[model samples]
Target chain A: MSAPLFNLRGVAAIFSAEMARTRRTLLQSVVTPVLTTALYFVVFGSAIGSHMREVGGVAYGAFIVPGLIMLSLLTQSIANASIGIYFPKFTGTVYEILTAPLSAIEIVVGYVGAAAAKSIAIGLIILATAAFFTPLQIDYPAMMALFLVLTAVAFSLFGFIIGIWAKTFEQLNFVPALVITPLTFLGGAFYSIDMLPPFWRTVSLFNPVVYLVSGFRWSFHGAGDVSLTASLGFMTLVIALCLGLLVWIFRTGYRLKP
Target chain B: MPIISIAGVAKSYGSFTALHDIDLDIERGEIFALLGPNGAGKTTLISIVCGAVSMTRGAVRVDGADILRDYRATRRKIGLVPQEIALDIFSTVWNTVSFSRSLFGKPKDNAHIERLLRDLALWEKRDNKIIELSGGMKRRVMIAKALAHEPDILFLDEPTAGVDVELRRDMWGLVRRLRENGVTIILTTHYIEEAEEMADRVGFMKGGRLVLVEEKTALMRKLGKRRLVLTLAEPLAALPAELDGWHVELESGGSQISYAMSDGAEKGAAQIIQRLGEAGVHIKDMAMTESSLEQIFVDLVGAAAGSQP
Candidate 1:
């Protein structure tokens, strides 16, 4: 007799299943986000673009584009990943995943990777939609892509953590809708911190999403309220923190083991 | 070789203990049944052995690899059918079972998958979503998933619970075949009858402790008993002095008399009939009742529970 072996085959298997599951509910996974992004552009971009002048050396329409993309990235990533993890617990499918020969890391990669990929796709769709509202430019196209992926990965991992921590369906929606969504709005998704008073501006800097949005904006416009170096450093720090938290949760089997 | 060896394994959730000071060694090619009532920690013990749940104290070795230190190795040798039927409803059974196999790092073996599906009578359902299958079919899928990795030792925690009788019988037969092929199976079930039917050895657990573990037949012979039930033609006012040596219960408005006898080399039903006739109870109808596995289980747990403070 030999001890079991683990390979990416298991990860791929689980990943394939998750992707299939997400794809099956194409309305929620695909159409809903597309419609939401359209609404965001129509309501926030077109309606608010005319009154506000260029705040970050970019037009109001263009300035909000990156924020809009990040908004979709964060919400979609979190929603997809959270629902992905939470549904299994709800339907009892999680037991199959947990009892499988796959390691926890493999489970994380399969689930969070699928979630991040989904978020990136939805964010890209929203970004594409932004093209109709205002002409967008990409100063650092490669960097922009990299930041988008990192942001999706980070937020998806965060959502994965939230999914595990949440016990019920309401608890699942509570944090993302109430906590993360509010933070994104206040993080200057549709506006810049420069317009805020000094105290509020200082306070806004504490929001991690601000750095993500600012970093993403800098990638597109080469202009942001925060320094590029600081934003990149801050995003890097956030990624590390998210990864560390996930690894610790996996190691501890937090809310995973019965 | 023993497929699994559990030493001093214990699991606790905060202040509440789930399993206490448990030790189990399961040999290859045998079905070991863990019989316990609900909340007796049967699932906890199996989960610990299968690497699904962590033990607070002690260790488990699967095929000589420590579960905690060498999880991949240990897990590869084991398959777990949890008490819950957890399946991705949207995914086809083929993908689900194949994924479970690959999760153990086994290469793509399509033939093996087909054989398993066919054996479990799931080949047609392989292309169907798990949610579409009946409860019995889904249970078979759970078994297929556990067998996907071809583990040396499989842990089935209440596998037949709540399942239809046909499916339960099918699962028992499948387990028997697996045993024939040299897979050591550890099963937890509330169905003592299932244990009696399928187990080569049985371990009874009560209050988080294994009360007894022995060969099935040896346990039955040592603890099994027979009760002589006598229906009298006339009501007996009292037992005669000749029957004083035996423990007898008067029932059915004193028209029936029962004598419980511990099984031994010399004791037989003939002796009870002779004793009753000699006592002049004027028996009209007589029958013997043999203790079932449940009776043995009840007796064991009842005695264990009574000894507690």
Candidate 2:
């Protein structure tokens, strides 16, 4: 029999393995993000919001919801994808993947697909938790979903690259912890770039996370520090760059093959 | 057609050459054992064929499909059980095997998987996590995972390394059964006896080059030596002139005589005995022994080493 053009079963196998890992580590995968979101609501929405009142004509408590979800989405996307691939490399089980009748694209689709799904789930869960704290509105639900998915997929791809690039566990976590988290914080996850001084605001424009948060926030409150088109454009650019890098990685075999 | 054909394949890492121009072809449904010492490029060669390592030069084909160009087609036909027990500790025995089958783009065959697990003696522990299984069970799980996709050829890299004697025997039995079912087998091993006991043909590698490849029995017959050892009735001070024509040695302070014969020299043993009898030498006990594969292996490697500058 001729082989199928696509190894859909291979992709599904990787996807389910990653998802099962999530289910197995429910506390780390789901609960921690939800609890962290709750803590943010308790601290920022209750204590801090009671004093700040509103930001950009939206309640301060409601304003940070999109940013918070973006934060979790970005981090979880990176974490899921990076850990998913890195663990196999670490355990030497990647031989099975490398030897299987799988193209690099199929491998990426399986890993990134699961990672994006996970972060999306966490993003929605955080959104629901945000709802319990303050009333929320999704002005463009479809656009919101678009931004959520695109951001998750883009970052998950980036994480897959990190997973391949990393030689050690510390290196595996370095990009997400040292780089992505700080970028998320400074990218107006809690405060708007409009609130930043002029000079710093221009520098904030250089931070890619700003575009993601702004686009997601606009989907929720119909307002953002940047234009919606710019946000979407930046999202597309990030996705394209990540995909390009992934292609090169697989083509070159990078750290994945010896 | 041969199930696997490797031609002019070489792999190098910067300044270090791991494998040097190697050409080999493995026949269908036969057990081909690759015997070599460490750093002899056995694993590197296997890795190149299995697509785990890129070859710096040349091509490999599985059933006429080029390995690099038709990777999916070639890879689908081969299963590799690497030396290391690489597995997801968190995954259960069943999921591990099933996942492997799916990874090869095979449709879910629960029945096939069940039978496989049963065959490997892992059925009862199918639900148990890999970490929960013993080392031997984990090794069997690796075998199960490799076979899950039902590949036409299997490459076992040191399959019995670190395994207990009984488990090794079980694995040997399993491999024989696999061959009986028409799965071509290529195994690289440090254990010469494993090759001697199971291989139909054997290839000897030394320092990244395949030095010798021959049918196991033929190799033994060609390089094998025979020794006729006799316990002399009395301790002799020296060999008699009549026995000097034969390659004989006096051991145990001249209390025993050992007659050595190379291939096609078995006729010499009877002459040596007659010579000893004519010389009034009496034998209290006599025994004959043939050289083992291990001895032939050491001799080949030693010769190769000696031939090196």
Candidate 3:
């Protein structure tokens, strides 16, 4: 019998199961991030802005909107995707997926697709909440949406790698907690890297998150700390690297099969 | 033709071999039981065929489809009920079963899923989360999930381990029905009687090797032993010279004599009794028993272990 080139139904099954899990944990998945965004707006946007006043010709409160959104986007994307794959491995339910008639591409699409979708939803929610604190502007609405989607998909795939690599619960929470969060904070989510000394600015260029936040901010205000080309190049490079690593993982069955 | 065929299959973890070179074929619609002690590679073999574990060397074909080259086709044709109760605790029984059906590339078929739940006696608990169900119910849900996609072959790895007797009977009935519906069933179990009761053919694995495979009845006939035991009315210190030609052992402090009936020994029982009368030993009572599958399994495994270097 001729088999279909793709198992779309299997992909949809995994996607829907993951999405249903989000719905079941709505309070933790959605409400927690939204509330955390509200708190950040209250302290950093309103309270701190009263003293700093402005940054790079925009109100201090409005300047951090894109940064705030990017922070939540990066963290949530990783958390969602990591937990999505890791939970199954932890519970031993992943045998079903591994044994199913699904290709590696289909499995990735199902899991990473759901994770990206969820993070994007939370990003949009945070954007809506941020609007309550500062008037927003989108110089290139299409570009803003593109950057949002690319970042979510790229980081979600990265999170998928971490999920597979993690052997214990502590390891599962390690990268997002100790690595990604620190990088996002240092990537100029709160202020422009240009405002730093030339030495610090040079060191900041090594941080990949800087490009993501810069491109995202540039889409909102038509200006950023880095050139638009560099930002887009960095985002594409991250995506390519993540996809490459995933291909290797599935091919070797690293940490997934023994 | 065999629904599943294995050739030169082997698996190793570093220096340790989990499964030795194994070759076997399972016929269509037959209940084939794999009998072995712990660490005998039963689960490893199943995992290799089901694509859960990578094999060091070998090839397997399911329904004429090469397991590696045409894995999607092969996997779609088989359903596996793993030994562990692996499930999402938050997922309801309905969602779990339906999702499994869809995962195998089948389109939404609520009718089939509903019928499966009812047959497994899980319809009333369809809406309950997996964590809320009893262990027996969880096992039933696993069965429901495996059968959701209507596979042509089902691998039940230790299907009734730790299960109550009532549910074990229920599961046996269900398995028979599945076979009747033309689904080939393969199971690995420690319960020897399970194999004796349900398996048309039985394969014994020992120390990662396939040691024996035969029809259940034929295995019994070939290796089964019978024993005759007599209780003495008067204690005897030793057997007389007339019984020297027979294999008999004195036991119970000289109050009982046990005889092992070997090939062509059916007539020996009468001759031994006549000799006992002639030797002036009064017979009290006697009983005969046949070796059960459990005894045969132990002896086979024990003998295999003894021969290992």
Candidate 4:
């Protein structure tokens, strides 16, 4: 008999299941983040806005909007994907999928694709919520959307790697809590790298999140801490790295086959 | 051609071996049972064939396709009901089963899924999430999902472990029905009776090796050992000199004497009784029991344990 064909039905099955799960956890997925972003707007907008008035040539509230949205987007994308794959590993349901006729890339597309879709939806929703608090402008709407999508898919892919690498629930939380969150905060999310001391500006270069923020903020204010080309190059590099690592995972059967 | 063939297949975890140079061939449309105790590598062997566990060395082919090179082909031919309760606990039964079918590239067919649910007696509970169902119900869902793709070969890994009698029988009936449709079935179970009743051929694995594979009836006939028990009319304190010459032991307050009768020991019982009568021992009753697969399984496992360590 011929090998089973690869079809959209397979991806559709997985994607639909994951989307339904999102709907089921609507409160946790949408409401919690929106509420948290609103709180960030209130506290940071009022407390710091009165003194500085503006940062990065934009209102304090608007400057932080992209930062907070990016923050939630990254975390949510990771959480949605890592938990998505990890729970199956925990429950052992993944064997069914692994033993199926679908290729490794197909499975990745199904999972990472679903995660990216959710993160993008939430990203857009957060953008809508931010409109109420501060005036917004988009110098490059297409580039902004591109960055949002690329970031979501890249981070979701990163999350997929973490899911396969994590042996326990504690390992799942380690990178997100101790690594991603801290990096997002320090990578010029609240303040432009130019505003920092010369020494601090050099240190921020080492943080990859700075590149993402710089490109994304440039889409809004027409300029950022770094050139748009460098930001795009960095994003492309990360996406390639994530895909390369995932392929290695499938080839080695690391933490998957036992 | 054999549906599944394994030659010199071996698996090792670091230094500890899970399967050791195992070789076997399973013909199409046969219910082949791999019987072994826990840690005997029954699950490991099946996992290797299904491509869930990579082999350290050797090759496995399903339907004439190499498992590693043409993985999708082999995997598409096989349906595995893994030992774990591997289901999304919050997904409804219909969605889980249908999703499983699509994963294997099978088209959606509500009528087929409906029949499957009806066969498993899960049609009424189709809307219930997996977590809300009982353990046995969840097991049925696992079976449903495996058959959803309608593969030519099915591997049931410990299908009835910890299951109630009703569900066990229900599952066996389903297996028989599946086989009737020309689907080859390979099942691994520690429950010897399950193998005895269901398998056309039985393989005994121990210490990561395939120790024995034989037709069920032939194995029963060749290795069958029976026991004969004689109830004494009166309790005896000790055996007489004539009885001492025979391989018999007294039990049940010395009122019963038992003897292990190997294959072809046709006249052993009669001769022993004749000698007992000559010794003035009155016979009250006699009972005999043919050895079952359960007894043979214990002996085989015990022998393997003894030989290895």
Q: State which candidate has the highest TM-score.
A: 2
Order the numbered candidates by lDDT, best leading: 3, 2, 4, 1
The 10 consecutive residues of candidate 2 chain B with the worst lDDT sum are B260-269
Give model 1's DockQ, 2 decimals. Answer: 0.53
> Which candidate gets the maximum DockQ versus the true structure?
2
Candidate 2 residue lDDT tens string, B1-309: 888899999988999988889999999899999999999999999999998998899899999999988998999999999999999999999999999999999999999999999998999999999999999999999999999999999999999999999999999999999999999999999999999999999999999999999999999988898788999999999999998666789999999999877766667878888888999999899998899999999999999988866
* Backbone clash tally (model 3): 0
Q: Cα miss at A26, model 3 (Å)?
A: 1.0
Sorted by TM-score (best first), the order is 2, 3, 4, 1
**Per-model i-RMS:** 2.4, 0.6, 0.8, 1.5
Give the residue spans of candidate 3 off by over 4 A.
Answer: B231-235, B253-255, B274-284
Instruction: For model 4, state the Cα shift of residue B54 in Å.
Output: 1.3
Report the Cα lDDT for residue A247, model 2: 88
Query: For residues A1-258, could you state the per-residue lDDT of candidate 2 as single tens digits?
Result: 677889999999999999999999999999999999999989888898989899989999999999999999999999999999999999999999999989999999999999999999999999998999999989999999999999999999989989999999999989988999999999998899998889999999999899899999999989998999999999889889989998888887888888
Give the clashing residue pairs of candidate 1, or none.
A3-B73, A4-B73, A4-B76
Clashing pairs in 3: none
Better of 1 and 2 by DockQ: 2
Per-residue CA lDDT of model 4 for B160-238, tens digit only, reads 9999999999999999999999999999998888999999999999989899999998998877777899999999999
Candidate 4 lDDT at B11 equals: 96
Per-prediction backbone clash count: 3, 0, 0, 0
Task: Tell how far residue B135 is off in model 3, in angstroms.
Answer: 0.9
- Residue A87 of model 1 has an lDDT of 88
Q: After superposition, how far is residue A13 of candidate 4 from its true place, in Å?
A: 1.9
